[model samples]
Target: MKNYQLKRLSDQPILQTSDVKPSIDGFDVLGAFNPGACIVNNEVILLLRVAEAPGARPGFVKVPLLEEQNGVPTLIIKEFPEPEEDFDPRVVTIEGKAYLTSLSHLRLARSKDGIHFTVDEKPFLFPARMDESYGIEDARITFLDGKYWITYTAVSEHGPGVGLAVTTDFLDVERIGMILPPPNKDVALFPEKINGKYVLFHRPMVSDIGRPSIWLAESIDGEHWGNNRYLFGGRGANNPRFAWEGGKIGGGPEPMLTDEGWLLCYHGADETHAYSLALALLDKTDPTSILDRSDLPLLSPELPWEREGFFPNVVFSNGWVRWPEGSDKAGQIWVYYGAADDGVGLAELVQS
Candidate 1:
């Protein structure tokens, strides 16, 4: 558990400074949300999840900011005068009343140094009619063959699913539609095509067959995916109290392929929903085969900002960047994650 170390790069409130604010007519100018980062055109570009309030009752409909009216952003909030009798906590409900929450949309920001960022005036990607009725969340970007393939979470009343989008110039994005169906999320596509096919890691939730665990899938084309197989399962330590991760583990940023294997950074959560980061090595040829894995966490909730917020004790990542080799401080991966479902956080991972 102590072998791995997680250095804080950018802690909570990564976008909370006075300079950063939700667009006047945007959805999530104030709320802290998740983000995806990539090195593009010598600058770090971030696609952030913008969550906003719907002005409805606390338990009622949640809205998404897609358009502006009179220079003010508008939210499409669902109005439910009457709710159902039985409701599920995880699905979306506070009390007897049933209402929707604001869906996730994409906002654009750029940085020269990967630390300081300036947000774009207008949203880069808005919710489209295809499969994003509930909005998008946690985009994982992979640059391959001159195209940027983005895998993100598409949420709706049915369930949280995975969707695909592509961009060539970062400004124009073409929606590829939903690749993974409902009850699935936390998907990351490999940087390159594996055996002439695209490989991706995903998690499919099954309350009956097995616990929510990581799964692997491959596709000839990046859009259509198949050959789903179980990648990893939950691990319970003998001493329950000492186990930081027990419930589930999911693939985080794009896996870094090395001569030894594919270095994977993933997130694990305990029963209490406390999340931490872990590292694993998979066979370069067959990513489904595990080579090695860290028994302990590489990063965990330690700081006050990380330990407290909307959903406390969580550090979840969607993207990372590795420093180039041949330098004094090479072989380092910068992980950009969401903190407590509020703001974004960063961690530095040096080769061990």
Candidate 2:
């Protein structure tokens, strides 16, 4: 029952809301976090989930969304009267409809050392389709089939679902539409085909009978996914030893193949909604079989920045990349994570 430890690369968050500029005129960048990291042509590229919203007015709650008018996509702000019901600062409920205080879109941030990044002024991928009317978020990048396959969450009136996009070069992208439907998110593809099929890990949210947990799915074309199998963290299927994730758990970064097995980094939340990172190892031949997992969290909200922000006591990640060949830290894994939902931080995964 050994614990996995991680080394914090820096004392402070690498990127914050203030470092990003808003895509829309009236909106301001609220947060920049949960970026998908990969190396393209020797540079570390991060597809950042940039959350933005309009400033609050006197008596109205503001919600920002992407709307279509005359076949053109437009960013619009919707206002609702303050409600009597209990509401979260990030989400407001008005007459049975839920609206987000801010909308999220993916933007590009490039880095030479994988620490300091220069963010693009404009959004690299935004809500253009009907399913993404709310916005896109938490992109997970996997380079497979000679292209970068981005699996992300698309939010709309329907709820959060998994969407796919492909790119050979970061400058251009092609949307493959929504693959997994509503109540599902935290999707990440395995870097290579397994058992002659594309394998992926996703979290299908549960409300009534079960808990939100990780699931495995298979695909032939990488666009259509099926053969769902429950992996961990649901009711009755007890994983009590991993009680830190007693509330819910989900897949994080793309799994990296190792000599022992496939190394997985996932996030979990407890009853208090405190988020932390954990590790697991799955059989290389049959990923459905879990070999070993972290009994305790690998990384948690320890620093002030990680303990406070838009969402407090949260340290979530969807991205990690091995320090490239020839670099001083070549063998170590660099994890890019969202700190308290407001800023980006870096950590080195030390498997002891």
Candidate 3:
């Protein structure tokens, strides 16, 4: 029923959660979904992923820490009670320590017509240092050789790693820290520079040392990575055949090379975390191989803002915006997802 050409763009929420004052102190700014899209001079750029809280609920847990005190930037808040209701509910352990109900950073959006985005009042990238002190999340922007090379998702308290930053004019940015550490993340790279080296795609869950899937690394010098393999995972854990892609599968946005080879727009989830949107096709010069995919979904989560907010049906993405740039046999891609994580959805694949 949908082979791609699903356009929703924006009914609301291009970016939210910003009263400016964030150094802690009451908090309140709770959404702004994942982004990391790009285009640069032609416009359409989004690095968005802003989440803040104070009254963040849903089984409880809110921890945000980032300090500088007298030098300025500061944010600290940690609260966890009620024995730590596990069994999902977005995790909130207590004595053993665990957090994350909200608090993220990196905000900046602009669009010429990638679908009307224009966010930028504050937050260029927050949570500075101490391993990102519990904030900073899912970015994945890679332009390579010329400049633009983000790769976010830092989160502190010693978990969820994979951070690196660089910008030519996203207004001076250059963090570049943990390449792929604690639990890894959907780190992405590979815009150019493949056959010679530097090609990444991370997702390392390390539950006991396995099952979280999606790997493939190689770097001549894009920040000291190693040579990990894997690729895409999910056939167990939750992909009971494809219970909507079974619960875990990542590596979305930032892959697109095209000529019918490196498209790769992924993001699946099932087992109730319900997020969808798929597309795969690699092997430009051996992008770890893989040929074609999208056995069913090219997008899902049926409207209603992708089925209600704060993570309902989900539909996450890291970025998109393709056009007359090397012609993938067609033109106009535009993607940019993140609906039901609450806001940010724009479709348009169009490849004839």
* Top-TM-score candidate index: 2
Model 2's alpha-carbon lDDT is 0.90
Q: List the residue pairs that clash in candidate 1.
A: 22-29, 25-73, 32-342, 62-100, 62-101
The parts of candidate 2 lying over 4 Å away from their true place are 1-3, 71-73, 234-241
Model 1, 304-329: lDDT tens per residue?
A: 87888767898888888776665343
- In candidate 2, where is summed lDDT lowest over 10 consecutive residues? 234-243
TM-score, candidate 2, is 0.96
Q: Candidate 2 residues 1-352, lDDT tens each?
A: 1545778999999999899998888888889999999999878999999998898898789998878889877778889988766779898878888888899999999998888899999999988888898889999999999999999999998899999999999999999999999989999999999989999999998888878889999999998999999887722236666566877789999999988899989998887888989888999999999998877888899999999999999999999999777977788789999999899999998757
Listed per candidate, the RMSD to the true structure in angstroms reads 4.4, 1.8, 19.3
lDDT of 1: 0.73
Per-residue lDDT for 222-321 in model 3, tens only? 9998888887776546445577776678887678786667877778787787888777788899877887676566778886767887778887887886
Q: Give the best candidate by lDDT.
A: 2
Per-model CA lDDT versus the true structure: 0.73, 0.90, 0.75
Error of 2 at 255 (Å): 0.5
Off by over 4 Å in 1: 1-4, 10-12, 17-20, 23-30, 56-75, 80-99, 237-242, 325-330
Clashes (N, CA, C under 3 Å) per candidate: 5, 0, 4
lDDT head-to-head 1 vs 3, winner: 3
Error of 1 at 226 (Å): 1.1
- Of 2 and 3, the candidate ranking higher by lDDT: 2
